[model samples]
Target: MLHKLELIDIKTHKITKIEFKKGLNVLHGDNGTGKSSVLEMIGFVLFDFLPENQADYVRETHSDKPEYGKVRVWITDIKGEPYIIERTVGKPGVIVKDALTKSRIPEIRGVNQLKAWIGRNILPMHEIELGKLFDSSIGIPQGTFINPFLRREGDRKAYFDPIMQLGVYEKVFKNLNELNKKFEPDVQGVSETIHEIIGEIKIKEELLQEQESLNAEIISLAKKLTKSESKSKGLKEKYKEIKKIKEQIDEAQKKLDELNIKSEKENENLIDMDSQLRDANTAKQICDETKEAYNKHIKLSSNLEILEQEFEKLNAYKEDLRINNENYIKESTHLKQLEEVLKKAETNKKKLPKLERIYQEHSELVNKIKEIEATIVEINAKEEQQVKLEEKASNISKNIKSLKETLVELPELVKKYNIMKDIELRIKEHEIDVANLTNQLEFFKNNQEKINQHKCPFVDQTCKNLGEGTFNEDIFNNKIKTKEISLQDIEKQIEKEKEEIHEKEIFREKMDILEKDKTTIENYKAQYRDYQDEIKALKEEVRIKPQVIKDKKE
Candidate 1:
């Protein structure tokens, strides 16, 4: 059996020393002292129990606060040999020492090292008949776990029988008889073997208990499996219902897709109609612009013709002036010749002054003759110039009258060209516009039947209840609106838009009629201007008179 225990620096104590004696050593100390801790350390150092109480004296009172503590214990071995087991906190690990010399042992230097060392030296108290083999308060035995190894064979036999007689596993007859009394006290099986030992019978009963425990575990596991299978079946049924609902949703989606395709076809037709209408309007506008430009060009050409007539009249007046200039040149030549005669007369009058009155009178008569001759020459030249000027003036007047008549005709030609072109282009444009509008109107009319036949109803659900049916609109409207717009409101708005567009089309038609009437009036005005110009030019030509001149001497 084991002997003394000594504690140093172990739990709840700092540097406290304790000692124990052999056989029964009871330790008593106040709470928070090292008494129980000393018992725990001895049990660990000797029999490998109470590992947590190994030898650390310090621990963290709270996780946030820690105390570093160390512990060492002295225990006696089976032959009364002493050894020290030492432990410290804050990283230096376990240490085991020779008790007498206080020198450390190498093998017992880890946290679990002490457990292995003790297991080599000690038998657990429960495995032995601990109460009979060792003391209760302190576990040192009288003839304990150590004694079996130390004693002689005869001594060992004595220890074994006494312990065997007291334990749950004893001889067969004793155990069987005990069970028999408990189960059937007054009855005994006859002719059966009675040689079974009590210890063997007791072993058989232990086997039966083990089988009973195993059977109970099997039953519990089977019940759990059955519950799990039922739950699996219920979940499968729910999955099947969910699959059916998905199929219904898919069918609804396919129907909605067909409706959408029909609606798209209708929309395409409507779009084509709208595009055609816009193209027709554009063509009409282009034609009207072209006609207006042609009319403007015609007006400009008429103004150019009038300007040419005025230029021709100015040219004729220049020609008459040239003829009068020839008359002026002849008159100048006659005046020079008359001046020479008068100078000769003056000279003769100066030389014959001695002849008196006759010479002077003759000189005066010559001077008069010269002056009269100069006057006659001037008059004849004037007459000649007037005749040539009158002839030129008549030619100029004839040319002016001819030009006026041609100019009047030009205005009529320009007006006629403009009116005809305007009327022809306008008629062509109106025909094209009418064709386009008719095609567009026909397209819309043809598609309207298909659009009405295949309209899809929009469906929704308002609540999560299983029995509730889907919600939908009764009357379908083909137009798509913004998310915030109500469907019923859009249906009403569509009718109003249709009426407004129809009114615009009617107004366009009336404007086309007015344009045709304006073109006709313009043509009439051009023709009237041409006739008036021709009549006025003819009258001016008739009203002109010819020039005349009388003969004269030079």
Candidate 2:
């Protein structure tokens, strides 16, 4: 039952309110007195559509186009609760409010949702049933009752098809009901139990992982145990060999001790030989002096015999000569024994050639010692040269390594340069796209009315659907928003590419520097090789130096 009806800016009724009684309601009017228009408004408010042309909902005005129009119906549902259903022109929303609280029902958002909600909750029928009842039963058009059999077959089928599909829905609902019943008859703790089972499964998986790890550990330990056994067995053999080696070492130590004692005795004998050589040199010098003096004494003795003959001729000293004649005889005997000693000294002097030979050999050994010292000095010089060459080689190696590292990066840097170029080109293209889209969006916004007069009014460019002269407001607005969004998107892409190009540009600079450094690699390599050759020659010289000194010593 409709409790009230309200109309604003509708056909022939700018503002009208009508109240209906609880049992019955009637509209008393003549023809063309706006009765049918009120019925259309009721149908439009209740069913979200006018039973007649849709445009009839807009107010019929003698002025320009109307801006707003609405129809509201206050009705009592089957439970005797009053509610309001409202619909407005140019808006797709249908409002249903609790008449008691006057609060809008947010659940009934659009016309379709409200229809579905009314069918499901308010009436035990579909939305199409309400439309059929309103069209054919409640507000049957003026003379439609005369058409008993002239209804089109398609119209009858369209009406009957939804009814026929109820059987399928019945079967579907039957199956769904069974499925619902087959669910747990008692689901009091099912979710908790499921959670507990899942936790147990997770714990079981964890324990399995732990068991696997422990098994792997056991296998690894077993392998280590086998290795340890092998090592222990080898260690026992090594211990035996070490014991034998200890015995051999003890024997070698005894030999070394004996050799050390022998060396000490030989050193003592060398000291004795050195002393004997010195003594022999001193005796040769004394022998040479004694032989020369004995010759002088012989000469003097001949002279003295002549002088004594002269003394026999002089009788004045004859008495003094008789007093010391015994002493003079003793002196002559001493001189004869000294001449015999001189003869033995001359025999000793005959070995002076052998002493000279020994001295010449000693001089040769000193020369050999000097040569050995020179060889050592040469070895020191060679080692110093070797060290300098090694330093040079090390420096060359460092340079080579630096060059290698730089060369390695050159390819990647070049690749980055190429990538940066590609990104720069892409960024330019994207920026161009952004500019084009911005122009299109601006042209559409600025020339909206002119475009609508000509074509779809949605885009700046000419479209295929020309000359249709139809306008869809939603499509027009959405197309504008989409173009602007695309412009923004392309601009954002250009910004991102600019950032990428910046990073690649930095890499390109690095590539340039490294590429220039690539020429030095061969130079460093050549220097390294030359240094290595020089080091090899110096090492050879150092190696033979000790042997040269040894040959000199020998």
Candidate 3:
């Protein structure tokens, strides 16, 4: 219910206030006295439409410069809560406020907000459009009731659809038709995919047949490889036996070489032994002479050792006597010094009380100084705290000033932020729309031919009724290119796997050969060690043979 309407400076006429009653109201006036202007203002405020120019509503009796005209409508909601809606003539915005709270309802800016506000607070959406609602139900315009009787049948039905609320059913049917159109393409694409899969199945069957033939050939090769491996194994065993025999022969040859070396060393040793035998008598004679001379030297050395021992005893006794004399001299000097020190101690004992008194005074003064220093340190700390507090207060003042300035601009900033947020929301909605379009494009590309063949159930043209646009052949070509790249990748992966398998087989064969070579090397190393041991023994025997012969000669 409209409780009040206030208008300012409206076309040489100003309506300051107009009040209405609860149930029924009437306005009757002369033709030029602005009777219809009130209804026009009501339509402009509520339904955002006016029969006359909004600028003409400006008062001509006002100042020469056009002044802003305003319309404020006060209405009661369904719950009887009062709301005030204000609009300025020739302005682009409206303001809605809670009359009780006097607080503005934010976000009521343009026609959409006004409509939504009216729907939520004053009337239902269909009733908020006063022209339509009045024409259809409550109040008929001058010619509206007679026009439908004169119209054609189709036109009459069209006019009646909104009155009977049959347009909603038409919208629902249209949406269902669009949904069916969208699904038809998907169904056709699926059918085409099934056909492609069937064709691939036939190709796979042929490949399987070829694979079976390859498997047979592989089995034949495997049998041949097994036979070759068996032959190689037998040959390796024979080679091993031959290697062992060769090692034995080499060992025998090494021993023969050692025997020959030993024989030659022994013959040389025989010659050296005979020469030593001849020199044996002469060496024994020389040894006897050296023994006689050694006995005389031993007797002389014993007499000299006895004399030297007696001389050392006499020298030790003299050294002891000299040490005693030096100690007696040191004791006499020390005793003299001690007597002098005793006299000095006696002299200093008289001054001990005075020194003790001075020390006590000095200790008292040191404690007093420390106490004074502690007090000074505490005072400095308080002064520093006072300085810090002053700085803090200055900072707080600056912050308060800044806060006041920010508060002044807060409303405008909030409004801008809201506008930016709305723009961001719109951008995000557009991004979502783009993403949906991209997905639809990709879908069509992936199934272009199939979608192209799909026909709309309601329309004769293929894909004509689709909610999304028709398939793009360029996108389909790109999808084919992508699939081709993927196929190439798969082929490369298969080839890489085959090469890896071949390399692994080659590595295994090499490992087998290495194992055999390692065994052969270990056997050879053991044989070489045995040969070295035999050579060492032969050399030792050759060295001792001459020693034995020399002992026998002796």
Candidate 4:
């Protein structure tokens, strides 16, 4: 409730002040005595609006027109700070000032800052006609008339809805009660018994996994035994074949050594031809050197003849050049004297025209520049005054535009405010409904244990609805199977396989050595044959040079 209200310089009046009472108070007078405007003035100050046609809309739209629509309100604080709320209308912008400090308050749109201030600092008007409460008119006393608080068509569903919800609450309660009756002892015993059974099942599962891993290991070892048996048999057969081949090779080598000695005696004449071929090669090298020097002497004589011809040509050209030099010097001196006279004549010819054109252009441009500078100075002088007027005009125009916008927004503001009031009423009804629902929820929360443990008649269906307590055996079985492959069991199998691979690798290395031994034996047999041939050839060389061989022996 407003404690006091004052209107100052609002519309036609220069100044007006009014006071208000704390309790329910009405501002009343005959129809056109500015009584309605007083309410408008209160709205303007505390809420910011004025009735239509109370003030001239045109003059009010200018920012500088006047602060004629100012209103002030004084209120008591039941909560926090209280001050007179002042609002200025009929200006470009609305001004809301806190009376105590004289500082302006920020204007809030959509939500009322002034009303919120009152809510925080003073008692908010309590609303009793919550739409849902006592919704049916039958609840009211028959002939004791009640004040109309809202339109008859205003939604009253909130008052009737909770009555309908009692059925839902009844169903929830009946289910809960039945659930509790069947629960208690069975739930208490099963919870403990189920935990013990699950513990035993977990132990059994671990034992089953260990037994399965041992079985897998036994099977793997059996396969390894079968493969090892096969490889051992193959190695024995190859060893026998290698021994037999070695015997046959030994017999052949003995027969070849005997034949090699007879063949060397038949090849002794072929060795003597190589000595004659060496002397013929020495004579051919001496002949090649003597031919190269004879060609060098002939090339030097041809170069001497060319030099004699060039000497005669130089002697004739020198005499001709001496005669030309004397004539050139004489002509050059005469030409220089003529060139000097021509330059002087040309200089005088160019000076008069070039200077006259320069003076004419300079005189013209100097006069033109002076006129431009004077014009620039004149424009500069007026710039300051023009700027001042432009600033003033701009400020006035901006203020006028702002005032017009606020005036135009006035109707919208009232419409929004009314809509907001309706929303607040609806919200109050919802709050009551929510409070009732919360009370019902507390009843359920207080009985949770009984509900969770109840042997529901539709246990499966209840589980389906509640999404609880369904054990997936297939997923669990697959998981158990996966767990059966213990890491230790896998590591043991890996070690056995690695050991088998290592044994096979060693066997492969032995086979490789056997193959290399065969190659080395073959190469040694070939080298022995070559060494025998060289010994026979050296004996033949000693027979051909017997004296040299005899001297070496001495």
Candidate achieving the largest lDDT: 2
Report the C-alpha displacement of residue 473, candidate 1, in angstroms. 61
Which residue pairs in candidate 2 collide?
none
Error of 4 at 500 (Å): 68
- On a 0 to 1 TM-score scale, where does candidate 2 land against the true structure? 0.29
- TM-score for each of the candidates: 0.21, 0.29, 0.31, 0.22
lDDT of 2 at 197: 98
lDDT of 3 by residue, 428-523 (tens): 334334333434444445356544566442233467434466535355667656655655554455455444344433443454455455555555
The lDDT of each candidate is 0.55, 0.75, 0.68, 0.54
Clashes of each: 6, 0, 1, 3
Clashes of 2: 0
| TM-score, prediction 3 | 0.31
Sort every candidate by TM-score, greatest first. 3, 2, 4, 1
- What are the runs in model 2 whose C-alpha is more than 4 Å off? 127-129, 152-554
Q: How close to the true structure is residue 79 of candidate 1, measured as C-alpha lDDT? A: 64
lDDT tens digits, residue span 1-554, model 1: 44444443345554566555656666665766666566555554444444343324454343443444555666665566677765554445577777788777654545444543453454432233222333333454335547565765444544454444444455567889888887673344432335356667889999999999999999999999999999999999999999999999999999999999999999999999999999999988987879988789999999999999999999999999998999999999999999999999899789776678777888887787676566556556655555555555555455545544444444444444434434433333343343334334333333333334432211222233222323222212222222113423433454444443444334434444444544544554454455445445544433331211121121
- Single out the weakest 10-residue window by summed lDDT for candidate 4: 129-138
Worst 10 residues of 3 by lDDT: 427-436
Q: Cα-based RMSD of the predictions, in order?
A: 64.0, 34.5, 36.2, 43.0
